[model samples]
Target: MSLIKFFVLAQLKVEQFIKETEGASGIEYAIIAAMVAVIIIGFSSSIQNGISAIFTKIQAALPAASS
Candidate 1:
């Protein structure tokens, strides 16, 4: 999508959030969700490599099953 469209959508959401009487919980939830997503994306590569190494080690240690 175009940057303008993205900005418009974001502005609308922000306005709605601001207008709500009980907005603190909603904002807190959004912030927590965003932080969790950032953490997962940051660590995902390391986690993937660790899991790959573990599987490789297990395969090397296991003998081939009889046919």
Candidate 2:
């Protein structure tokens, strides 16, 4: 095709992309998922530490254990 036609088509595609809002929601969902993952990881780390402490305390209560 002609260069003018190519440019016109590109302009139309750019305009359509700019006017579309579908991608915005996807980004928002991605951000929400990232935040949720961060929260889960943060809580899980603390939970793991707490569980480890409980196991250590239980271990200490046992007799004939290594010093």
Candidate 3:
């Protein structure tokens, strides 16, 4: 193929790819979901630790049972 023809074909392909948005939106949603998942995972560990400490404090506050 001639150089000009090759460049024209390449440009057309690029324009067509840019015009397609379905895959772009899906990729964006996947990225957002991944970030949200990471945030949830990070918060879960902290929340678990906080809940454990609260339980420990509650146990310490309780009076001992009589023998």
lDDT of the structure predicted as candidate 3:
0.92
Q: Which stretches of candidate 2 lie over 4 Å from their true place?
A: 51-67
- How badly does each model clash, as a count of residue pairs? 0, 0, 0
Which of 2 and 3 is the better model by TM-score?
3
Candidate 1 lDDT over 1-67, as tens digits, reads 9999999999999999879878789989999999999999999999999999999988877766432
Mark the 10 consecutive residues where model 1 has the least summed lDDT: 58-67
Candidate 3: segments with Cα more than 4 A from true spot? 61-67
Which clashing pairs does model 2 show?
none
Give lDDT tens digits, candidate 2, residues 1-67. Answer: 9999999999999999999998899999999999999999989988999999999998887764654
Candidate 1 residue pairs that clash: none
Clash pairs for candidate 3: none
Candidate 3, residues 1-67: lDDT per residue as tens digits?
9999999999999999989988888999999999999999989989999999999987877755432
Alpha-carbon TM-score of each model against the true structure:
0.62, 0.57, 0.74
Ranked candidates (lDDT, high to low): 2, 1, 3
Maximum-lDDT candidate: 2
Could you tell which candidate, 1 or 2, scores higher by lDDT? 2
- TM-score, prediction 1: 0.62
